[model samples]
Target: MDRRQFLELSGAAGGTLLLGSSAAAEATPAVATTNHPKPVGAVTYYTEIRVPPPEKAAVLAKMDELIALMQGKAGYLSLSFKQTIGESTMGRAYPNPKKAILAEALATLDGTLSSPKVPYFYVMFLRFDNYDNLLASGVQAWFKANIVPSLFAYNAATTPPTKTSIALDFHEGVYTTVAAADRVNGYMTAEEISTYLASKQSDEVAGQYVSVNNHYMIMDVNREAHYNLLRENLNGNTRSIFRPIPGDAGYDDSDPDYVANGQPAAADNTFFRKAVTREILQNAFPEGEKRNYLMHGVWETIMDHENSHLDPRFSAGASQVGSYFIAHPVEPFYITLKQDRFIKSA
Candidate 1:
């Protein structure tokens, strides 16, 4: 129940719910237009990748042989390879291993999805419907003809890409949850506690990306095994928030009060329940296709990083908060990520 209560139930942005006009799609109040022509919006992207700890076993055997030689290509969605824990090849069963979650869940609009940010190294997300299908989906020729020469052929290379952001899914919802243990015994993984309950009931009760419903957990992980339930869920701020809303662009997250009198700016010290999800097996198994989705909610996401400082304007503007969020892209942040101060949990 964080991330601004999951974006206040997932809706409250400046625009999107599809209606561009027509007197505000019938005087736009919220929704209930009907008469067909609206189902087209769900292009969310997040990115980051480093991989160069000695080419982590040839980039993990050429990305598992290019995801098993393009298994079920055709608008592939969900793909992750975040690095930092020494660019893993799947050792330590991916625990405390820095970061890595290569997703792949597509709904097809025909190719082209590269650059969710491409910072340190890996960042891919291709959701087309505009920008000329992001340029006739060869998706920059499958990232320069197949994921950039298998990502620098071994010794970890590729790093010459930059993208601001390209969001356009006026709205899209998905929330089916279940949780328990919360008095802070620490443990979240029902798809990272249903993505923190859709990042806070998104738009509260209904709005933006709305679909799928089921939730119940009541209690499970806290019995005082020594206390660490996420440092009392970041002590007091209860659900933390600093300033991050607009399109949620490429977040590698860092600065959630960078461990005591430090970080501040764009902090995200791994908290959405503890990010962890890897399985781009070409949409895993959408139950024989046809837009079904939900195969164990595909690799839950959560990565408890831990870092809290409980206000002080959080380390006094922690290192320019990621260049002031890449230079304040016109500042909109609809639901106001809890009145941004760059979130705190200390």
Candidate 2:
């Protein structure tokens, strides 16, 4: 069933079973409590690396080696590598390829940084227990001592060490779980919600959601009042909680379909469903013309890429939406919604 249908059925059931007057009264908090202790949140480090066309392979190999080395470090949670495919990387992939339809959609959405020149080959995410653990992990030192030298060694003969190029950008933040869902509905009691919220402050529950193909929303918000509001208005089936990991963090590196001998895994893209509300969609793409941008630009682009690698039917609509992204990479942004403000604005 589609996500909307499932939400409808589940929500109705939840209303009947859990939305009694007493429960409803208790659900909304009068004032945000400050007594609950804060949990140890995760620290996430993101690196956007650009490699010259000729040096891509060598750089990737060094990256693999570095990742392997990090596996042994204390407090290391997970690491992921995603190749950036948009305007920045397009020219390198196809010297002269046709512009993509999705490219037009992206252009319509935002003009800022519309034509990025840096050809980023990969974006890496590394997660650790906390900021202190991240500092003690020695990842930054290792990267500087080992990986940085190889990245610039391409011009060792002609260029001075300082003149050699090493193009990368770094950002760091803490993970805050905004939403968590399980298949079961109408099972959470008010007491359960309170306990869960309190426990989540210090618990590593993000991985649990990943294992069940449940949605986990991570953000940077630290206000206790914000979370209390979410707890107050949470749909019976949907529990909004913060995690200490990046929103895009994956649980494990093993292939999701390893058990099925490489067949298209049913669990490949099941964790987060597409947003059903106009407000949520608009938050991601504010432009009127780009209302359906996620469906076309993100979802369809991903499906096309997966199908190309897995299905490969010759007659299929082989639209290279993924290729279009090489020249027009999607910029990552955060969306924060306040329930009271949203309702008033609506």
Q: How large is the C-alpha RMSD of every model relative to the true structure?
A: 20.9, 19.5
For all predicted structures, in order, the TM-scores are 0.22, 0.36
- How accurate locally is residue 37 in candidate 2, as Cα lDDT from 0 to 100? 26
lDDT of 2 by residue, 198-265 (tens): 22221112221110001111121322343443333333212221111133234232653322112221
Quantify how close model 2 is to the true structure by its C-alpha RMSD in Å: 19.5
| Ten residues in sequence with the least summed lDDT for candidate 1 | 331-340
Q: What's the lDDT of the predicted structure labeled candidate 1?
A: 0.23
Off by over 4 Å in 2: 1-39, 87-100, 103-118, 149-346
Candidate 1: how many backbone clashes? 50
In candidate 2 the C-alpha lDDT for residue 262 amounts to: 21
For candidate 2, the per-residue lDDT at 64 reads 70
Report the Cα lDDT for residue 194, model 1. 28
lDDT tens per residue, model 1, 1-346? 2223223322223211111112212211121135312222222122122332333355445545544433333333222232211111111123333333311111121212233222123322223222223233333333334333332222112353322222222211121111222212222443443233223222311221111111111111221221233223222222333223223343434544332212222224422221121111011111111111111111111112122122333333322221221111111111101111111122
